[model samples]
Target: MKLTNKHFRIAEIMAAFFTGSQTEQDERDFEEWAKESDRHKAFVNRLLNPEEYEENRRALDKFQVEEAWSKMDKRIGDTKVRKLSSWRSVVRYAAVVLVLLSAGVYYWWNGEEVREEVPVLYQIAAGTTGARLTLGDGSVVDVLKDRAVELKEVDGTRIVTDSIGIDYSTRETVDTAEIMNTVQTLTGMEYMLTLSDGTKVFLNAETKLKFPTKFQKEERVVVLEGEAYFEVSKDVAHPFIVKTNGVEVKVLGTSFNLRSYSDENSIATTLVSGKVAMFAGENSEEIVPGEQAVYMKETGKMDVKPVDVTLYTAWHTGKFIFRNETLEEMMSYLARWYGVEYRFIDEGAKKLQIGARLDRYNNMNPIIEMLKKTGLVNITQVDNMLYISSTE
Candidate 1:
């Protein structure tokens, strides 16, 4: 059968799955497709077998490059091509041969000399769900998705941690005194928390949030050191307040994202639903849904503007949405989530603007390939560091 768009999509999904980057939805779709016929099930099983993988690799090594190139040339017209430099590149090309035996989509391999000068790019895995929880008694606990634990705070507040997240809803606070607890997520880690008041907070990588075991009768308040998306539980009498840097975001009952990393030049608060009032020093601004409040740390200036909230809030939904963000800014975000260091060899490359939406859970290979295909910059990995230079 001739390869159609659907076949290409399936191939892409298979590649993602083999690379350990397929999403939950991808797995479901793949399993559903594989159940359509016995042939499909057998093909998936063959791919999963270690011996079959070696056989496929050996077959790929003998694929005819010249004939395959001729066919590809006729399909896409004239196009310039460059020789791949390393076995890593060969493996990448070989991964494209999904359903090869049945679809007749040829795999091409040229026995060209390997170029040692070219850098080899390695895969960097995505972040996972984990955090450090510090109770009011000054005890630190490592909270991970795979583990389950139960603890009682000094204030008699009961905290339960399960696969979903840290839950503080079952409050058994005996003392009326305010007891503070903090949840911190390091680089390449994220976490979710259910506050005592039933509010849900999604903490991003490299973020820290400090809250009380039980809210005061007057108000609910939390201190933030990095970034988090909050869905505040509605309580008309007790307003929810998030304090970060010098800015304060106050909402009665709403959902919003606040980003205030120390390394970032500015703090941003993006409102997703309902209303929020952001205060910085003497200046205060109220932002409705689909709006953002930006507080410049250097200039002590606050500005409110309408924005596509998804660009700022997508992290809560497992996506990285960039809207013409500078390469330096984009890399900073990636570096925090991927736990990889990056340097721009060509200083000018740092200023290049990039606009794309990427799956936050995907490994670095596909993300790197997407960036390289943009023809804007060249990215190569050495150890855990990514060197970015101009395509020129």
Candidate 2:
């Protein structure tokens, strides 16, 4: 049968169902369609049984069998048939079959070669929620997932930690002395923090933030060393200031994203709401909503320009939105979040610009596949390192 848009839609629904992301309506529609023909029911059964599917796939031509085995060995290891406990494993298994079926169906109907060849990518899990909290006394506490702990500072400030995040709003007593604390997230980790003044900070991977357990009466100051999105509590009396490197971001009540990684050549502060003033040396600029203040470390000059704030703030919301970004820049972001390293074999490929909006919470295979579909670069992974080269 000739493949049409309807077939593609059905394939999408089937894929969603297998991945356990299908909605109730989609499940109902799929069931209704499956009941129309025994062949459809058989296809669904085959998808449900991974062992049978693997057996049939191995019976294909020599090249297909070898490729399938290679991918399976690299991704799933030596175990050919085993019970999968997570939807992620199911996605891995079903994704291969779905891609092959879709391609084969199109080729059989249209008699055309597949338009693109997708490389088999090794699974690299996405970042998780975790961080290290260093108390004022230089004692360190590991903040992990699904564990609850209550910590009391020497000044009687109560800090609560849970699976969601760390909260510092609760206090047993107020003190004039501000006890400084720090939270650091390594690669493959992101975390959220609620300050004593109700300001919520979302920290990205390989980032560090140092703040006092209690803000001083005059000002709320925090030191950031990497990237963070700040929703400053509306406190007109005490202005909130974020100090990073040689620059300082001053705001009373505003939301913005600041990126001041030591490795990056420039520091970017994108205003999402309210107003923020970026100050570096003698240079100062007050950026309004939808504007970005980029400070070049080399020249000590600050430039303000309008930008799509979502592009910079999307990571706080668990998505990566890149537009016309170089391959080197994009890979740097991915490397930190995925806890993986990448090397460009073709140095010229570093300058290739690409745009993509991907979920930061999904497995890295889909993201790699999307990059491969761009057709400008080729990616291959060995262990945890990804090698990128130009397709040309």
Candidate 3:
């Protein structure tokens, strides 16, 4: 059977189900469906749990997502998201973010059903359950996970991370207290930070960055952890510098990737555009787009390679594209985005590898079916831990 747009629409409906804050009619429909047969209930459960979907034999369990979304809605609260002036100029940007946020993206198809096997690594990930944030000045912003935000006037920088696009607005700073600051977020999350000099940054999960809200004269600098992507603004006088996990990247006006995950044994900096010379005590050189600077956290050695930029930025988009990415690397992305802990009980999980592109925003089982269709691995779940057994 073939996967059709109906499944896509149903998946979107389930996305709304997982995250409360649904519309009036939607709630009524959910109630009606709940009163229906047990099979209907089982199908929804299958949709919620990717692991259950892969087996095709697991029975339904009470949905936990109802409680998860309820907690998320309360955490987000009545705080309003600041609107970006730039978004006003964008073409039809309002529909995408606003519509999807309140009611999940939807597309209905009146067609036949298709039930197909998924690829082993092909699985659906649940939406972010929500996260807590600690600000530099002890302030806290409890952001509902998966929700987009546009925050401006932070020490004079226009810092925003939205679906329209990651935009860094140029700002003028007049104070010194805002100079040295920190931006921190919890696990299973990511953010975009636009600096005063119009440099754009994307911060990954469980990341902490100590940066100046405003740049000092002649140099723009910051310290990083976890991962981030920077689109540096052009400034001949003030050079942008990023220090992370013992590696420093210096770029005048360029785009690059910085990985400083403390748990991982390596810090990687990939250049997507422009040029930059890295400084790591005597062993470093300049790099440009398609080149990655990987520093081993354990051995303290650097290796540079040319890579496909799409693989690095795919998460920024809705799809995870893998042109031969490793099994652990792929699972890590899913873990962060899905807000699930990767407890690999199977030591042989490393032997499993796959190459595919998955739009995780949709259904997980359909993706699982797609993965199994690849015929590379078998999957099982027990006690909320996913065990991936490699076939090859």
State model 2's lDDT.
0.78
Better of 1 and 3 by TM-score: 1
Taking all chains together, each candidate's TM-score versus the true structure is: 0.70, 0.70, 0.60
lDDT score, candidate 1, position 266: 97
In the order shown, what is each candidate's alpha-carbon RMSD? 14.8, 16.7, 18.7
Model 2 bad stretches (over 4 Å): 1-121, 174-176
Which runs in model 1 stand beyond 4 Å of their true positions?
Answer: 1-120
Indicate the residue-level lDDT of 384 in model 1.
Answer: 75
Q: Which candidate would rank higher by lDDT, 2 or 3?
A: 2
| Model 2: how far residue 56 lies from native, Å | 36
* lDDT for each residue of candidate 2 in 1-392, tens digit (9 for 90 to 100): 43443443455576576557789888888888789887677666655565564544543332253543454455554554554433234443344344343123221111222232333445999999999999989999999878798999987778899988899998877555779999999999999999998999999999999999988669889999989999999998999999999999999999999999999999999999999999999999999999999999998888999999999999989899999999999999899999987766445679999899999999798987788798776665645766565554
Give candidate 1's TM-score. 0.70
lDDT of 3 at 215: 69
